[model samples]
Target: MIAFFLQGLAIGIVSLIPGVSGMTVAVALGIYRRLIDSTKNFTKHWQSSLDFLLPFWAGVAIGIGLAVRLVAYGLTTFPFPTAMLFIGLLAGSIPLLLKQYWLATVGRKQLDRPLQLLILVISFCVALILALIQLNSPLSGLSMTFPTLWALFSLGVLSSVAFLIPGFSGSLLIMLLGFYALLTTRLMGFMHDILTNSLYIDWNSFFFVITFISGFIIGFIIFSHFVMAVVINYGQLTFASAFGVLLAAPLAIIVCTKALANLQGSISVVLVMSALLFLVVGFMTTYVLGLYSTEFTREHPHQGS
Candidate 1:
């Protein structure tokens, strides 16, 4: 349970990155299959699945609650280092994914198959296009109204779909839909108000929050089943596509964060070193975690599910 919570927290933290999918982190951590299996088969194994998922959900909530504020502040104050760190973490996970791929396809000629190759290219291109679109789009703040609330609910559903797809970021979709700023700002304000004065709350904002979360829960459950079916039927193809998307994520993050643009003019040696250091640290952290997760899974293959 503690392990699940920590892993969920890690996923939540990384999910803040524009192009980084939390599901991708689960994949890298060697728990993607277990997560899918448990979620999809919850009816058959409700007790065990609930025990496994409860802490994870709690951790996700805690991580997101903290990350929204911290990431907002970081983007405003220290965009470069912050972005570089996430980029490194995403990059580091790639090796672990490749190892998994190699293990799964060791005796098969799957990668050489034309259909698999096509799927990989198509997935990569689609993710690239989506990332570019998200990067170029402007985030217009939405006013709280019935229409906007419905839109937010719809966005939440779409975001859940993105969450299920490895390397597709739900937050990026929200940002593209022009509700990212409004959602984060309102959530922060709501949290502050609750902490400061719980009795005098804005019911309207509370309603919006509840509606969005409800949409996410519904969408997540539906999409989880769909994803589980895809994985079971086409494991290699699905993961191949996911691998392509993962490969594109670092580039997307760099583009979205404008990190390259910041470094283009009069690059300082100290700043460059600092960025490099942070990147390396992030990479090492995730890589080590990946190794640990791999070992843990091997030792307790059926412990969680």
Candidate 2:
């Protein structure tokens, strides 16, 4: 129970970062398939699975509850530094994912080395080019308004779709919608007023939350089930493409983050260091949690060969 909650909370926090994905973090924590299986078979493993998932879901809710403000403030006051930190973390974690996927193919004598190398080279080059471009990526500079409720709902739906997809990042979708900052601000505003006055939740804010949650729930459940089915049916080719997209994402974030002009300052070094620290933390957390474990063959009983 405790482990699941902690893991979910950690994943939830990671999901707030632009380039990071809760799905990846869940995979890193060794719970990706388990969660899906449990969700699908909610009848059989209700006791144990719910014990693990409920707290994790609660943690996700809480982390988002808190992050709604902190991320907003960070972006508002120190956008570039914050973005740089996230980019660094994203860059550091790529190798870990690569290592995991590589190990998954161990014992497969039929696996083509050339094809694997080709995929890696192509992914690396594409990521490099994307990194260079994002450094100067233009901003929309758009703000959210009450009249834009439909737009916000739509953005939430899109983000939810990404969240459900294996290699996609909900935060990246938020960035694409240009409301990355706007929604963060509104979330903070909602939080501030909530604490200032008892029983005074903003109806508008509440509606957004309800709508976003609705979209996220509907999208995540349906898409995850479908994707899981596909993976079960076609594991290798599907994984290769998924891995390619995953590799491409952090590169995109790194590029776009550095492109922001405000990234230079005295605190930049410290921030970068902090980001590196978290990057290491992310790697260690994923590694130590048995997320990248290559010894599950006996238990899962798959023919890597």
Candidate 3:
């Protein structure tokens, strides 16, 4: 339970980054398959599934709540360093995922290397194109009308699809749909208002939030089932495509960092050093966590079950 929570927390934090995918972090932590399997078979394994998923869901909620404020502040105050840290985290997980693939196919006599390569290329291109589009035009600040609420719900569903796809950034999708700023602002504001003065509640904002969350829940469940089915049938190809998208995530972050820096004008040497330090720190953190997860899984093979 504790492990699940920690994994969920890590995923939640990483998911806040524009170019980082929570599913990639889950894959790195050795929990991706377990999560999908549990979700897909929840009815048959209700007790164990709840034991594993409850804490994870709670941690995800808490982590996202905390990350919104922190990440929002970081982007405004220290965009370069923050971007670098997320980039490092995304890049650091590549080795572990690749090792997982290798281990799964260790004794295979004949492998479809060409098909895997093609899938990888296609996935990378799709992710790269999406990232490029986000860099060129970032949308924000839409009014919260009934139509906008429906749009937000639709965006939530689409973003949830990205969330399920490794290396695809859900936040990037939200931004592209022009809902990122409004969503964040409303969330932060709602929390603040609730804490400060409970009587002054914004019903419209609350409704929009609820609608978006409902859409996300519906989308997550549907996508999880779909992904699990695909994995069961085409495990190797699916993982290969996921690997390609994961590889491209860091490049997307780098592109966004450059674009953001340009918008902010010249960067100083001190800032560059700070960003580098954070990048290295982020890389080492993810690498160490990956090692721990690998070792843990080896020892407790049936942990989630």
Model 1 scores a C-alpha lDDT of 0.71
Per-residue lDDT for 115-191 in model 2, tens only? 75566567556555645544556444433465566666666777876665444568865664455655565566677
Top-TM-score candidate index: 3
Stronger candidate by lDDT (1 vs 2)? 1
Worst 10 residues of 1 by lDDT: 296-305
The TM-score, computed over Cα atoms with residue i paired to residue i, of candidate 1 is 0.79
lDDT of every predicted structure (CA atoms) = 0.71, 0.61, 0.72
- Which residues of candidate 3, in runs, are more than 4 Å off? 1-3, 27-30, 104-114, 145-147, 165-169, 172-179, 254-259, 262-266, 295-305
Task: Compose the digit string of candidate 3's lDDT tens values, residues 1-305.
Answer: 89899878878877877656687677767787778778878999999999988998888887888899997787777877887887777667666555545544544333478988999999888778866775777554566687877887887788888888654668755654446667877888777777788778887678767888888888887888886445334555766877777777776665644536633667778888988898898888767766755632463232210
Candidate 1 residue lDDT tens string, 1-305: 99999988878777766656687678667677777768888999999999888888888887888898987786666667777887777677666655544444544445457877888899788767866775777454656788977887887798888788654668756654456666777777778778798778877667767778888888988889887545434556766876777666676666665567666679888878888888898889767766754632353332210
> Judged by TM-score relative to the true structure, which candidate is superior, 1 or 2?
1
The lDDT, on a scale of 0 to 1, for candidate 2 is 0.61
Find the candidate with the highest lDDT and give its number.
3
Q: Give the per-residue Cα lDDT of candidate 1 at 67.
A: 90
